[model samples]
Target: MTSPSELPSTPAPTTEFEIFRGLHYRDQPLVLPNAWDFASAALLATEGFPAIGTTSLGVAAAAGLADGAGVTETETLAMARRLAGLPVPVTVDIEGGFHEIPSAVADFVKQLAACGIVGVNLEDGRAGSALAAPDHQAELITAIKNRTPEVFVNARVDTYWLSLDHSSTHDRVRRYAAAGADGIFVPGLTDRTGIEQIVAATDLPVNVLYSATGPTVATLAELGVRRVSTGSLLYRAALSAAVDVARAVLQDAPVSSGIVTYPDIQRLLPAR
Candidate 1:
């Protein structure tokens, strides 16, 4: 692995970058699925999703570490490297920059870009359930854009997820937009009124987290949201299915759940 300090100042053009960015504004809102590893990502690609995103929760839990604690940097990068060969564009959830210095954030993203990831989720939430000052978060976004301009920077604002009001969110989004962010993500804000306001507030594409109780994708598209992400939902569902099937088998009861065939999974790899 190339050390962050030795990362190149400029990166060559990535083949998937333009395609990934264009998916945001297509006829339908981009419904991004979060994948934890190569098999999950490759399966989704075969299932016809145009792009894939990495879930920090799934990545951390699979490695027996905690999410949002800034402990998964190495693991996250390693997973990105392993999944680099997938057929679709891959974006990663890099929680909270993982370092105090803006340049270090740039260096970490540099490594992922080298691995061919086309996008990233850089959030503003920190440890201890607090939010980073808006200026500080925007500085991090600017640094990433400076070092890796080809990578789509999805600037995540965790205000609603942290149970805060919407008063200052527009301001925060504005600051991040000026910093050259390719898009804006507000994970917990689901109401159309607020969603509409955020989309109208900036020219940047607005990305919302997929909420079962929230507006559907078609509805969100009508209201002008360009992207909706399934963050960690698939990972949690996989865990539940794993436990359920195991319990059924041990009790000598019929397995009453869906299963993927071994041959189908084997097809996910490219022919060598």
Candidate 2:
């Protein structure tokens, strides 16, 4: 693991972004585990995930705010600060830059760059609309990259998630890459053909959100995907497991097996 202190001094933003990009497509594609808070990020870092990411859904849900509603800017910033203190590279999901205006969004990326974050996932869900106008979102991406060239901008197009009537995922990716996006992320992309198309269409590295129905790491790598993000899956699974355990205890049913022991969790916790 590369410690923050050991990283080159005065590193260019593009340099840092390339380093993270290089982690992808290596022996194994970079499997990014998303965390909502400091402890979770630190725990994953301690467990040897070379990099950690923030989940917008988990961050918003923990604060009782609506996810993808642009309500967690401050919370995300604070979380970035906390995660930066960890030993590994930190990437944050600044959902849609928490604002529509390009300058406002660009300023937000600048703030994140100052917080020692090497990368950010900027989505184009467009608040209440299905997906932001491709041109409008591309403007935002270009503004962010021009302002903070070193920050890896993982431009996320949520056409699949929003169930939009888009015929060309390749076209969408091309627009973002022309706008200077470092990488392209297509969440809710589970089909092999679609994944392969996007991976081949763009020169930028492709990031796919991990789904139970989606291709496995080896398969995604085989198809030329560079990064696989867990997104909100881990957090959602943890919630589901908690509910299942509680229900079993109340009904006098047997607890699930493979529960991590308290001692194991203790060892995972940061030393006091």
Candidate 3:
């Protein structure tokens, strides 16, 4: 089997969208770190990430809203506007497009594209943990593409995440690909064989949610995965660190070293 690294490199990208799209067709999979807010996004950008993504769960949780409940559209858009100035391109998760109507969903994505966002993760999973009809989801993908051809539409299939009828993964991905999705994201798929099969199922880039216990980045790259996302993991880990440090303070235990200082965070903010 030929490795992506051995393949010929493509021409240089001329646009932000092209830059982001090119990240998927590289020697190694694009390891995307999901940020919940401007500070997190900025920090990741300064740390040298090629691009940044917004975790729907992280955004919803920070705003005290439930993830995938379709209640954080405003907050999500607000975050996109705030992160537009970051050095790297940004993609956001618009859970189920925040509306049942395909056009309305596309309109919301247009708002993000206007904010200079280069990509979006539109999932088929809906409120109440139900998966939308494949055709309906495809309609949503088509509408977004028609409205904003430049924005990378990462059509997400939640069959694996929701653990309902895993057999539908191939058909769903092919349907979205036919509908013009720029990529396919399967969030709970981590096993090597599963990843390989899905990557083989479509010509579009394949994105998998990063799992601590799953295949490593090098392994995923070898499996032909194109994009690996740390969805909500960073935010959750930050929360866990905060609680742990507080507990240590109460116990008079030595704090963890190498933690980011207050000044480091202050520096990440705008000068004005």
Candidate 4:
């Protein structure tokens, strides 16, 4: 079994970061799938995803902590350390920076960089039913960039996500872009018109969440999106499948014919 430290503790090549950033601007959008832990990330890398994003929901839920509560900092870094050993670039979701002070967020990002993570999703969504003041979120983004200039910082605006009047959504995007964000991420924004508006408004890469009711990856690429993220969809779908399988097995129903072998994951685990 290969421990994280035993595998390697060095940052990936600088080209890895460039390759990840370049993926966003290719003719096709970078379709990023979110992974919760080592096995999930390893599986995605083995399946040939050039990069993977961490889902805060899956990280918190796996440990009985609630997402967006700022309680999983240690666990998040721990997972980052493990996933650093994978063959592809890794980006993390540090929800709301997990701290109020801008410098603290910067310091946290430094830690992630040490783990070889090349990018992060820092959102403006708040704990309460409100959005972080755009100016404040920009401050955090600036501080993180000042501290970790090498890490790709994706600034996420939650205006559309919170269902707030997005009269100033474009303004928020501009603020983040000015603050040195490497990309712009807008979750819950699916309208082709609105997406095009945002895309034309900034030179930074535009990232949108994938929606079942909205544009597919190819459609998003046509609309000028640079990246398409699955967000928590993979994690949620994994949870659903586990529950459904458990119900079937407990109810004496015939189980599915096969399951993917997890021996490689076992090999990667340390023997007690």
lDDT of 3 at 159: 97
TM-scores of all models? 0.92, 0.88, 0.95, 0.91
Q: What are the Cα lDDT values of the candidates?
A: 0.92, 0.86, 0.95, 0.90
2 or 4, greater by lDDT: 4
User: Candidates ranked by TM-score, best first?
Assistant: 3, 1, 4, 2
Error of 2 at 8 (Å): 20
Can you write out model 4's per-residue Cα lDDT over 1-272, one digit (the tens) per residue?
99877896756446767878877877888899999988888888878898999999999999999998788999999999998878889999999988999999999999999889989999998887578988999999999999988889999988898888699899999999999999999999999999999999999999999999998888898889999999999999988888888999899997666665678677655467
Best prediction by TM-score: 3
Give the alpha carbon lDDT tens digit for every residue of 102-167 in model 2.
999999889888988889999988678568888998999999988999888999988887878557
lDDT of 1 by residue, 18-136 (tens): 88998986888999999998899999988999999999999999999999999999999999998878888999999997997999999999999999999999998888788889998
Model 3 CA lDDT for position 137 = 95
The per-residue C-alpha lDDT of model 2 at residue 239 equals: 91
Order candidates by lDDT, high to low. Answer: 3, 1, 4, 2
The global Cα lDDT (0 to 1) of model 2 is 0.86
TM-score of 2: 0.88
lDDT of 3 by residue, 1-272 (tens): 98999999967899999999999999999999999999999999999999999999999999999999999999999999999899999999998999999999999999999989999999999888899999999999999999999999999999999998798989999999999999999999988999999999999989999998999999998899999999999999999999999999999999999998899999999998
Give the CA lDDT, 0 to 100, for residue 128 in model 2.
Answer: 83
Candidate 3, residue 2: lDDT: 88
